[model samples]
Target: MTPDLFGRHRAVLPDWLALYYEDPLEITHGEGRHVWDAAGNKYLDFFGGILTTMTAHALPEVAKAVGEQAGRILHSSTLYLNRPMVELAERVACLSGIPDARVFFTTSGTEANDTALLLATAYRRSNTILAMRNSYHGRSFSAVGVTGNRGWSPTSLSPLQTLYVHGGVRTRGPYAHLGDREFTDACVDDLKDLLGHTRAPAALIAEPVQGVGGFTSPPDGLYAAFREVLHERGILWIADEVQTGWGRTGEHFWGWQAHGQNGPPDIVTFAKGIGNGMSVGGVVARAEIMNCLDANSISTFGGTQVTMAAGLANLAYLLEHDLQGNARRVGGLLLERLRSVAARVPHVREVRGRGLMIGVELTRPGTDEAAPEAASAVLEEARAGGLLIGKGGGHDTSALRIAPPMSLTVAEAEEGAAILERALRSV
Candidate 1:
């Protein structure tokens, strides 16, 4: 069964669309944190389809909202009044810390990011963009233009001129040996020097935590420090919160909050968790920036009634259950448990990340060499033991990504940890 479907998938889908495992499993359905393949084998889903399943599978609230909205109407153009869309936008605007915030909905993170770039470029009247090293925004031409990760970025031909910045990752770089404060100062100095040599960029877009960069992050307050400098230069700061928004980081509702002393970013882009499994994404910015464009604009499929309903329901559920608090409490324990296990594995080089978005990097014993093969072996072993996870890195694809639903139970976390321990040992 798996072989037949896999063949069909390869024949029809784009070759670049990746599938996991040597023999990929087709997920038939899911409930809670578990999913079953076509063969009826259940596995604990840790990656949550690249962290898109923000809440849980088959959540009653989301299903009911989607069903009821579908029965009424699936879509209505932006020319008409969309109650659900307006209501969801209101809720998000309030949640976003930006002053006098305004929201524009889109169908996916890629489109949301594209819209952000359009606004930033138009407002600043410049095409130059500042992007962090080992960062990924999206796959669209404009978004890809600013991405600094060579593995994910495919082309140099772009509408925007991009300048790469440092300090996204704290453990690996020329300044890796410096103390936290010194490292922050050095990166800020580098930014100042770069700005001196180049034109003023439209905005500096960055992911608070680099998801595809193996969950690497800089020291806290580094961005805030950078913010002070960018503000002096009349540049906009954009926070790419697709992966770190809606309380996934445990310590803060948004990843940008870790560096919030300088106030909110000029623009905030979000997607992944807001609609749970539904297709929803949006950009939030201060009224000045969001209203900068002089021309008419609309998203053909964005803010559709069905997706808006899902977003409203999902937001209410997430807040009602205090999933953010749950993430902090449970994630703290899970991180400790995983670190304990990693301590015994000779090939495990690092265990990092906050909240449920954890990463385990694999390397050759006694060296900093990325052991991509060892990561693959661990992934296969974990899947064979009925656990599903994810893998990513800067370019080598050598880190295990463990991001389960925000509502993960303690028992389930322990179960997954035990399986991961066995898998790492086997590898």
Candidate 2:
């Protein structure tokens, strides 16, 4: 049955839609931090469907809210007054640090970022954008233009002229050897030099933590320094928090807080885990920027009643249960365990990240070359050991990604880490 379904998927889906492992496993159902495959094999879900099942799988609060909303209405266009939509918007606006904040909903991170680009360009009246090296915003045309990761970026042609900036990855690049303060100063100087050479840029969009770039991140306060420079020139700052928002980083509610010395970003885009599996994405910004569009625009299914309901419930549960605290406690232990294991593994290049968004980068023994094959082998071996994980990186995709649901328990983390250690050693 699995083979037949896989064949059907290949025949219908786009070739670029990649799947994990040499033989893909079809997940039948999930509960808590575990999932059952079609063949009824259960495995610990460490990746949490690419970090979308944020709170948990089949969370009662979210599921109940979705069911209740669906019974009333599945969708209502943005033209109408949607109670759930308005409620969710209010919550998002208040949570967003922007003064006089406004919210615009989208169906995915791609659309949210596209909307952010539109707002930034319209408000700043420029087509130029500054994005970080080894960064990934999304898959939309405008988002792709700003993406610095070549593996995810498929085309060079774009409507906006994008300038790639340095300092997203702390362990690589020309400035990797510098101390944090020195590195921030060098990057700031480079940004100033780049601005001198080009036309005024619309905005600088960056992920506080580069999610798809193997959970790479610059030193804290780096973006704050960049913000000061951009603010002086009246250029906006957009934080792509699609993967780093909602307290996933342990120490902060948003990844931007790590660089909060200059306050929040001008525009913030978020998605992935907000709805706990339901499709919900949005951009939050100051009212002036959010209202910069001269013409009216509406999303057909962006703020559908059901999705909004799910988001509200999921968010409430996340806050009430203090899943962020759980992530910090469990994730810290997991990170320590993984680092201890990686210390003995020659192929383990680096183990880094905060909270549940940890990454273990693989490289050829005694060399800087990315060991993608080793990553793949570890992934397969981990699955065989009754654990599921993820892999991502730059063009080579040689890093193991382990982002479990935020509600992950200490026991679960220990179990998953043990399995992962065995997998890494076996590979």
By summed lDDT, which 10 consecutive residues of candidate 2 come out lowest?
1-10
All candidates: TM-score: 0.99, 0.99
C-alpha lDDT of all candidate models, in order: 0.92, 0.93
Query: Model 1, poorest ten-residue lDDT window?
Result: 1-10
Tell me the tens digit of each residue's lDDT in model 2 across 122-148: 999999999998889889999999999
Residue 168's lDDT in candidate 2: 94
Per-residue lDDT value at 74 in model 2: 97
Off by over 4 Å in 2: none
TM-score of 1: 0.99
What overall lDDT, based on C-alpha atoms, would model 2 receive against the true structure? 0.93
